[model samples]
Target: MKRIESIKNPKVKEWRKLHKRKDRDLTGTFFIEGFHLVEEGLKDKEMVNEIIITEEVSIPQHWKLDGINLTFVTTEIMKVISETETPQGIAAVCKQKLAVHPLNWSKTLMIDAIQDPGNLGTLIRTADAAGIDGVLLGDGTVDVYNGKTIRASQGSIFHIPIMKGAIGKWLPSFSERKVPVYGTALEGGEPFNKIKSSKDFALIVGNEGSGVQQDLLKNTAANLYIPIYGEAESLNVAIAAGILLYHLRE
Candidate 1:
């Protein structure tokens, strides 16, 4: 095993760059940190390009290393490359894959420019729990490869497939397929329970501040609002998404 110590190592600098979307694009690689996440990447096999491990850690069995490179480093060196304040002993350089929707999409989630990484990730994790067919992101949303988004998703990002497109472009595609596209909003909308979501429908959750776009609003089959029981004016986007997803699941 090779040993690395200095934070100034050229390889370390290049690894740090993987945190940014621009860098991930330039290299076609993104970083995954922590034992469980790296394990999850191992499960996805093809998505992981390389694995980095502490010198003493054991590579688990049943992982098909085949042609993947494994780099070993000191604990201090591991810390230097990690994005979290509390570093995970392992990380990986994973290949970025384009998401493709399966032909049989029964229930789906559409994300529209959700700028906050935490919210987007939380919504994604929730979508997976609800057994969504796929996730679609509109333009202006945070890069799904960003470290925080990946971490917040708790590795669910790897488990569920995500696709991206302009809202105007994809909304029509859903419409053409006879899938009812619904947006969660406050005005000019029906109570979520009032509208029925079955196997062939997509739910759109928009930006933290702006909500859904007006143009998309015109094309929506239904705009949904969570009827407030208390004086609370609104719901956090992720929570609202979970509620909508749960309501639709049955």
Candidate 2:
């Protein structure tokens, strides 16, 4: 174990760098805060690069943190690396391990340009709860490792495969596999329930404002929309995703 007390320390500088997307990309690692997320990282030991704890906090007796790259830092130092207003006093730096190729998925959730980190995170957590096999984050989508996203996932990020890529290039693979790919649209989309739910499918959700890209929607096996019978003009993307994910899941 290492003890770091200074914010000026080089190791602390590197740890702070994990706070940014570019740094995370360049280093091939990201930091996760909160005990649950740290626990998730610790469970997959090979993925965790380091575990950081504030000196003021004590490790739970049940934790299996033995032999890990553990570090204790001052509360001030913990604040430098933490994103939360009330720092949880624990965080972990973990290697990015998204699968290079799409998984052979029974039910996958494809997303396009979802800008809100909370929406993306909630959708992902919902997908996990619904037993979706993987989540493919298409271009223009917010970074999955964004702190708000990681928090929103509530540790579900570790439960499923998530990757980022140009969705247009990947849509064909689903078709080639004879998997049904569905897109969400505000208009000109079939009522979501019209298509009988199935065992194998990919559902592509879109930006909060623009909905799915037109070209991508055209390529899907079908475009779907939940009817708005009440005065509500729209559904939050996260809510829509929860409804659609559960409806489409086997």
Candidate 3:
């Protein structure tokens, strides 16, 4: 183990670069904070690039590590590299795996220009829970490689495949394949329960404030909404997605 102790170590500079989206792209790797996410990436088996550990840590007996790269750091070094307000003493750098191709997509959810990392992560977790095929990260959506996104996803990020691109342009291809594209809107929408069960459908969730893009929604085969009652306003994008996913799964 190559151990680092100084906060100003050269490796710390490299690690800190991972805090931005550009660096994650340049290095083809992203960092996951805390032990659970590190463990999650380990379980996926194909995505991890390196595991960074500190003196204050515990290793599970089942995390098989035959060929995995492991790096060691002192607590001070770990703190300087950590993304969280309170460092959890562990974080792992993982390669960004290839996005699942559109042809391979089945029942999936498309996120359109959502700006919240926490919302994006929660929706990913919910999609995994509902057995959705994958998530498409459309233009304007926060970086999936963001450390906060990884932490908020828990272990669910690995279980669901994610693709990123311009959804408005890419969705027509799904239309050509005859897959139903559903978009959510505040108006001119059907209830989520109206979604057909045991069929191929892609749900497009929009920005927290903007809702779905007008251009995309105008072309969607179906527009669905979760009803609110008792004088409530609206729901969080993640919660709305979970509700819709629950109905779709049923």
User: Please, what are the lDDT tens digits per residue for candidate 3 over residues 1-250?
Assistant: 5677787888789889999999989999888878788888888767887788887787778888668877888888887888777887888888887575766677889999889889988999999988898888898999987876776788788888888878987787888888888899978988877777656778899999989999999999889998898687899999999888777653
Q: List the global CA lDDT of all models.
A: 0.85, 0.89, 0.84
Q: Write model 2 residue lDDT over 80-126, tens digit each, in one string.
A: 88889999899999888896767588799988999999988998899
Q: Rank the candidates by lDDT, best first.
A: 2, 1, 3
Model 1 alpha-carbon miss at residue 157, Å: 1.2
Of 1 and 3, the candidate ahead on lDDT is: 1
lDDT of 1 by residue, 1-250 (tens): 3557778889889998897789999998899898888888887888988888887777778667878888888888888788788876888999887686534576888888999998988988999999997888889999988888888888888888888877677776787789888987788998888876577888889999999888888889999999889998788999999999988875
Cα shift from native, residue 237, model 1 (Å): 0.6
Off-target runs (Cα >4 Å) in candidate 1 are: 100-104
Candidate 2 residue pairs in backbone clash: none
Query: Candidate 3 versus the native: TM-score?
Result: 0.94
RMSD of 3: 1.5
**Model 3 stretches astray by more than 4 angstroms:** none
What TM-score does model 2 achieve against the real structure? 0.96
